[model samples]
Target chain A: MNPPEISAEILIVDDEEQIRRLLRGTLTAAGYRVREAGDGQSGLDEVAAKPPAAVILDLGLPDAPGLEVLQRLREWSEVPVMILSVRAQEQDKIALLDAGANDYLTKPFGGGELLARLRVLLRRPPGPVETGVVQFGTVTVDMSRRVVTKDGRDVLLTAREYALLRLLVAHRNRVITHRQILRELWGPKSEEQTHYVRVYMSRLREKLEDQPHQPRFLVTETGSGYRLDVG
Target chain B: MENTERLRHPGWGYLTALVAVSAATGIGYLIRPWSDYWAVAVIYLFAIVLLGLRLRQGPILFAATLCALTWDFLFFPPLYTFVVTRVEDWMMLGLFFVIALVTGRLTGRIRAQEQAERARAQRATALYELTRVLASAQSADEVLRNAAGQGAALFGARLAVLTAESEQPGRLVLHPSAALALTLVEQQTAWEFFSGRARSSRFAPPAAAGGRAYFTLAVAGRVLGVMVVQPAPGAGLSPAQQELLDAFSTQIALALEHERLRAEHEAARVQAASDRLHRTLLDSVSHELKTPLAVIAAATESLGATVAPADRPLVQEIHVAAERLRGVVVNLLDTTRLESGGLHAQLDWCDVSDLVNAALKIVGDAQLGRTIHLRLPAGLPLVRCDFDLIQQAVANLVHNACRHTPAGVEITVAAGTDEAAGRLWLAVADDGSGLREEQRARLFERFFRGDPGRAGGLGLGLSIARGFAEAHGGTLVAENQPGGGARFVLSLPLQHHEQVPAE
Candidate 1:
């Protein structure tokens, strides 16, 4: 498959030569302007010179720790920085993300996942969009009217279910932590009520999904939260 | 104390002798009319015996001579004169002197021998006590302080013990808490002794560079440190005292060596543990990383949609392989995090059906051609657990079964609460080969594969699955299905919840 027609330059900062080459081939094939830096210093220098539209930085760099570079960059630039984190970096990824990194992809990532996350980062920062009908897996949720239909048939849902579905649809591509979902649905005091979210999500899946057992749209991100896969 | 020796010496003895002789003569002269010359003579003789018992030979002789002269001159025909007129009186005086001399000499020798024996016993006891103290010391500093105090008391000297600091690597340190501390210069002397730059015999004092004396603390020819002492001026240790000091030094050296060996052993143990952890990571990462890499390598060589119409299969293989590799990596990372400690679980009151269904979907691709059955009862009370961890564990179990079971065999997944046990369990059973006794015993051990010949996986799945189960106050067990085949069960303690009202 050809890369998306994105003309914006993406800088990859990493120590692993093979990984840099793999990503370069993958990104170039996907129709994006790509730049490479071998170490943290080189990456910083390149960013200063070119000021790329986006940066994909490895958390473990050779010259300086990738986190140090990220912090330095965050001091000046708010350009979307997508980190390439490896396994066991759960804490570091969360910290980096909270510290202004736009997104992250674990090592040995599928080309499909990388492009998908890159697209999310490349898109302009999300703003509150007007309610509209959204279709996913034969289920159409008409948000303006707060109604849901599966396979052209009206599906019954409770008031809470509609609210839950609306929240997930709004942040469809990005993962919403369980605590965040609980707080949103059950109010601030209901942050500890994670099971409430799980029960409601199961009910919603049953009502809207053809195979509730095999979830295609409302997916659980293990050890994190949940993601709504729209595509 | 100087006069404590037999009063047979000249100084005090002569005074005592003069007093006895004069008193006896005055009494004899006053009572001379009450008796013959013999009566007065006997009184003077009695004075000689009293002086002989208390004084040495010189004083006794003076007393006997004075008694004889006084008895002859004063009690015989002539009085107040040195001349003795009677031979019998002279004979009597000589006989008394001989008897006095023999008794005093024999008794004095016995008293001197007893004093020497007592002193020897006291030295032996001091050495014994020092050995006891060193044996009980746990640290090198403790040994030094205790030894210094004991040595000072035993040898009548001010003592100091200095040890070489491990951090400073050859420089000596005097424990501030030690009983008798040495100057920094003195400690330098000790460091030189320990490092063998200064020569000193075991008990012999080191080079007389200063007023203080130094002895090396050595065991088996390995010098540990030194003890510096300043005995009372001119009151040097006897040969026996020197030997005892050497024994004390050796005892202290042995104790220090033991403490050092114990410390080294503890450090070696820590080093070994970290080494094993690193090796495990290296072995697992290299093997696991190469697997997906090999798959990606083969799939990319077939260049999807670029070379042939069969590009679809290669692309599908690539994605599947990539996802599988992702699972392997995630599992490895989770295991490392969990083992290294900080596996905080995010718990939710979850129905077992979610866990079973989620695990089934993830492991579905590995089923090849096997038929699966789900026997999870409806409305089972929710368990408080980390949903992701439990899901991963169940997925691992199903994956494990898929690999072991042959195609077309029935694989069963069942979940229910064991009320008697107050625990909830999710068990996966397969109609494949039943596990051997030995295999079942080590099934959950990390990197343990029942059949080493089988390809794929680092055999960490089952162990990690069990690890997750145990983390949630649960246990994972594999049993041979009684009828036949293998069964793996994950049992977690049930968390009582207020059931949500049904719609």
Candidate 2:
């Protein structure tokens, strides 16, 4: 999943000067080539002139709203974005994640936590790969054979259950909103039926995890969506 | 007064008729020497016709009779004789009397019609003036003043207006324009009508009930208030006048209702604008206060790794202080939101296990190597709640447990459901010394730090947890476990259960 070790660049788009300095210190200390943009227009210009490996975008910008910049950038770029935001703006976080943002960290976050989440965001491969088999904890899923085994024993799964598991596996380590789940599984008309995801998730946890109540691999983001942290 | 009472006294009409006939006799006598007897009769007829133009039926009839008698006695042939000598003279005298009666009757009818037309015009003018005045009034108070003035003049009465008080709608108070000097008994009667104990006396006969009548002013089934009018003694209203008063009451009611709606709308608009301003201010405060503390905390951590051994502890101290300040800021924001009625639970289907795990992770650093026991039973059904809020509440409980207990102590977290009550509960129990009596009394109070000497947090955790719990229609309670530690149990209701669609 690691890209070539030639030039791994990260672009930071934030209005606050001190925040930009702080982020630069953190990134450069971690041995990443860092680039900066003070406003949304400049940020877009910087990204278009020379694309970066990833972008750490802030939700608050002076020239235009961060959401608008994100929309404009997403039209032509597939660079992974990690949102930086304050805790008061919880209502908009879900929309950002659903709008192709890979992950997010609320303000006042610890330096170590930010780096850990950033590593996960950058570790993803740029293009889709066909993984014939995947494993987490004691459960093993073979995509080509359509078989799931736990501790060398066959585990029966319905056709719909297998489809649900494949969707999560495809977006593993990234947060996927309930709207995306419902639309992928039951068409767009079923967005209101969020209980469908809840029921299926519990069933999968019960079948695969050692303790279904405290799931390790399948994690819930609470108010946002779900994340499969296979790492 | 004379015109109104004219029909009551007919004797005065007869007296006037006698005087007029005597004058006519004198005129006829003077002309007798030069004219025929028929001409003398015609002069008397002329006098009766003039009286008819100015008098009613009774007076004109009297004048007609007087003319016939006077003409025969004073002007007929045979010099002041009562009898006529020839049949032709008798016939001529009879014809003159009949013609006088007919002419007088026709003229009297015309005079009565003219008087009726004038009365109608006066009523129309009075109503039009009242309507014009009421329409120009700007407020409810103005409406009351104008209505009272015009009503008293139009109906010849004293008027008082009573309206429901704006703040206390149950009771009614007199408006400033109440012109009627009401006695204690009359005021009590008005109150009775306002309370619906006594019905409105609309359409009652004029001057009924001691010369006072009450009319309720209402619009669209809502009673505005009552209007009481006391007419002058013995000057009661006619049915037509009563109808006009009804029209006035309707107009007054409409104006009052319009004013009330406008005031209410304006109040709502002002409140909405204030709420918006409050929200913007809070957002700015939260952003400004938390950003620098975040920088301090992160910067201090980075400085610690690279600093010399002697300076490492100093950097750590700064980090810890910044972290504590950050905690206070977060608590303050949560408290503000809770107090301002802005914390609404966005409920959705959530697994209790997930919430517990998320909470533990939030307070992970504070665990301090303590053993956490998870007793979440298998197959615990999902409950509906705001995932973020419930997780925060659980995290607060765990953090509270961690701070109160010594390092390496055990904390037990358990979960279960009561199917009969349809509730699922999660409890966090710490093996520290149980809470003291005084601490237990004010455990959930904001800023009530137990044992302030060992403080790390601003004691806002329990209150915020309770606030979040209540927001989800749930409850959080604290108690010392029987095994000698404090336990906080958060109980939440399972909102709904949907059948899983098979695929």
Candidate 3:
């Protein structure tokens, strides 16, 4: 994966001129090249003409909805996309994420939060990475060996808990919906049984986190889902 | 008056009968020398037949008797004496009498049948006119007006309509142009019919009291109203007229129901359009206000990087102020939604641990150096609720604790379930001073600020938290914990808990 020092090109597709300018200013200051599109059509055209390292697409656009643009882009490109949406649009955010967007930031987000989220998205590229080993907080999981160690000691985890941890580590720092987790961990028939995930998560937290209630890495997204915050 | 004319004066008919018999006698006397008594008898029968054409049964029969007597006295039997000389003459007299009686009876029956046919046609026309009038009426009010007017005309009576008030159910709306002033008892009777106690009533109030007939205006078992008709003094509705009135009421009820449905449909259409407009306006307003706030916060962050350390605090102030303004805008929108009855809970299954963590995330470490404890019990059953709404409520409580208490205070967030009561409870407790006696009573009032000097919100967080709780058929209450601090407990009903398979 390319680092920010490489000056990766970032495209911003938003209807508001001021928002685009702010985004451009923030990214350019953070050592990234920036491009702009005022509507969805131009955005799609720009992406087609020359794909950027990352795209920041606003949900609302004068020409077309951001979801359509994302779907159209996902048809051929695997470039990581970050969506900009309003606070009241949690459902739309989930839909965009499920539709191949890598991350989303609610509107009125501070520059620091935006950059932090973008950095994570960029660090974890679109295709699966060869993450043989991963570490967060005081815990380390060697994926290829199927072994998890906390503070230089082997920690006991049930088979389901180990699988859950693997899924979270696979997409570290990204929020996964309950539906997504259920489909992957159990069969799709158990999607409505969210308690399975909750019960298993509590056990994993007890085994790995110093204080299971105040988890450092494994985080809850309330109504949406769970996110493993490795930062 | 018209019905009286149809049954012409029997007195004048009797007088005409006498003149007809005398005319026959005069003609008989002139032809006596050249004619037999039978000839005189034939002339008498001719007069009786002519009188029968214009007279009813009683008058025509009188004419028959007179003509028969005149023939027997003047022409039959030993002239001018009441004696029967021959059996053939007596037989002739008897045959003539029988013929006269038969002619009178037949003519009377034909006239009566003609009158009955005319009456039927009149009723049919009246009913048809009423139907046309009611069908053309455009509104419920108009329908009632036309119905009453036509009904009054048809029955030769005054009519009053009492309808059920739609906006205020159970209240009655009496038609404005009602000519019949119903007495108290009559009104009660009308109400009884409207309420489905009676189908119809023939309320003939005694004496000079305004007697009336009441009919319930119903369609498909739903009573729309009641109709009261005050018949002309001393002229009550016959059974035939009552049946016609029944038909009249049925047509009126149908028209009223149609009009009501049309009005409801139009209102719903307008309301839907207005609701759509309201949602759009709110979204745009939020977007417009939030965009600039975002810019300000982001700009402040980037600006602080270049500013000297001494000036960084000023930039940070702007950032903090912008964030506060954003909160205010959100609160305003939320309150507006609540007041407008638009905040419907989109319920879903949720874990209490997730809810608590999300609230902490939203609070964002604003509680400088506070020691926050989590007491979420193991194996807490999942509860069904609107996840976002409950999260907001929990966040508001935590935020309220952070804002009201001094820095470094310990705030505990705990969750538990009351299985016996079928409820799930979440509490945010702070080791700050408990609420004052006066503040406890009005804490959840929309804009009631307990500590005016406190640098915090627009006094909306607690109120909004309560509203969200109620939306989930739950309750939020604030009381002093027994250990000398304030606690806000949000209890939500857990009715639909499912069986969790062992994992």
| Among all candidates shown, the one with the greatest lDDT | 3
Clashing pairs in 3: none
Rate residue A62 of model 1 by lDDT. 59
| Cα DockQ of the candidate 3 complex | 0.48
Candidate 2: clashing pairs of residues: none
How far in Å is the alpha carbon of B397 misplaced in model 1? 1.9
Ranking by DockQ: 2, 3, 1
Instruction: State the displacement of the C-alpha of residue B30, model 1, in Å, after optimal TM-score superposition.
Output: 26
| Fnat value of model 2 | 0.66
DockQ of each: 0.12, 0.55, 0.48
Q: What lDDT score is found at residue B121 in candidate 3? A: 80
TM-score, prediction 2: 0.80
User: Least lDDT summed over 10 consecutive residues: which range in candidate 3 chain A?
Assistant: A124-133
How far out, in Å, is residue B427 in model 3?
2.0
Regions of candidate 1 where Cα sits further than 4 Å from its true position: A1-3, A41-53, A64-78, A88-97, A100-102, A123-130, A149-161, A182-196, B1-302, B309-365, B369-392, B433-442, B445-460, B480-484, B496-503
Query: What would the TM-scores of all predictions be?
Result: 0.55, 0.80, 0.80
What would the per-residue lDDT of candidate 2 be over residues A109-168, giving only the tens digit for each residue? 777777777777777552342457777877888877888898989888787777778888
Q: Which stretches of candidate 3 lie over 4 Å from their true place?
A: A1-9, A29-32, A48-54, A63-81, A91-103, A115-231, B5-128, B131-139, B166-173, B199-210, B266-270, B302-312, B418-422, B497-503
Candidates 1 and 3 compared by lDDT, better number: 3
